[model samples]
Target: MRIVIFSDIHGNAVALEAVLAHIRHETAPDLIIVAGDLVADGPRPAESLAILRALPNTRFVIGNTDYDVVHERDIEYDFTRAQLSAEDLQWLDDLPFAQTVAAAPGRELLVVHANPCDLRAAIKPDHSPAIIRPLLDGVSQEIVAFGHYHVPFVRTVDRYTLVDVASVGFPRDGLLRAVYVTLTFDGANWQIAHHRIAFDAEAVARDYAAVGYPNAERKARKLLEARYRHP
Candidate 1:
């Protein structure tokens, strides 16, 4: 079975659309796994949720931001930012917190928004393996996927594969890009690939501008522009 994993849409429907198009042309996987953070932050959270609901075969688990926006205002979770619309929050509130499945015999997968061991478990990119390994013990899956750091990368330890696909809207790499995972089962082994690529920046930026998030729009554009130059 082949499954695609993605996270942190953060209301950027254009990025989500571009990534969906890429996935259709590429893996054509049987299932799409959403790691969470479906709305808020960018623009048009409601439209983003609509698009997510449109996917034919999608499974999901809420992200930390999703929880923050859903469960309560939680002034600590980027409270300075504007509050999401009642509809957006309601959609997020309706989502599940964590999802678990057995992709194949002896091969299991866990999806979450933040560290599986603890929602508050924070790890820097350069943290030691010892420090990182414990944060992973909380989930009992052969493969554990998560987001929230907004940094894209992967790590493998013991019998577990840690995939941090990053944020499609607020990437640390500085680009309007989407990160995804492709899981292919070959005999007894699981091949997990993390995919990241740029999408339509101007369209999403226009949405942000229209939504009155000029500050966020400017910051997002700068990230994308820097990536364009560097890449």
Candidate 2:
């Protein structure tokens, strides 16, 4: 079975369009998973949500930003939340915290936006075994797929496989491209591949000015011009 997993769209519809086109043209998969952070912090919240909503057979999870959209009492989120319809908010509110996908008969893949315990917890590529082991508590699946760090990585800890599918819109790897991961399970073993598709970063950055919020353009420009924070 072939499964494509992506996360952290963060409201950039342009980038999401490129990624969706690539998926349609390049391959057909059995399942699609959106780990989380589908909106907020970018230019096109409604458009982004529309694109994802149209996809078929896709599973979704709630991320930290997604949770904040519903519960946080902050003014910064108003514009993005306003663009969403009542149905959209309900969908976001109902998203699962985690899901287990059985790619093959006996091959199980656990999907979560971040750590199994907390949506805010991030598992960086360089974390020590001591730091990583606790995150696996109560997780029995041999393969664990997660996102939120916005950096793609495949790591082995004990007998478990950890995969971070990475971000689609606001990538912190400094490439300014959309990224996701595919996992192919062949009964016993799982194969992984990382895909990075390019989109118009400059145009999308300019879109922030018209996002209808205070200093939206400035905030967007700061994100676009900033250096990558993670290795």
Q: Which digits, one per residue and each the tens of the lDDT, describe model 2 over residues 1-231? A: 889999999998999999989998886888899999998877888899999988998989999888888777676678778888988988998999998998657579999999888898899899997898999998878889998998889999898899999889888876777898889887767999999999898888888876675477776765575345542
Please provide TM-scores, in order, for all candidate models, with all chains considered together.
0.83, 0.95
Residue-level lDDT of model 1, residues 23-60, one tens digit each, is 98988998888888777566766667778878998987
Tell me the TM-score of model 2.
0.95
Off by over 4 Å in 1: 71-88, 214-218, 221-231
Cα lDDT for residue 205, candidate 1? 65
Which ten residues in a row are the worst by lDDT in model 2? 222-231
Q: After superposition on all CA atoms, what RMSD does each candidate show versus the true structure? A: 4.1, 1.8
> How accurate locally, in lDDT, is each candidate?
0.71, 0.86
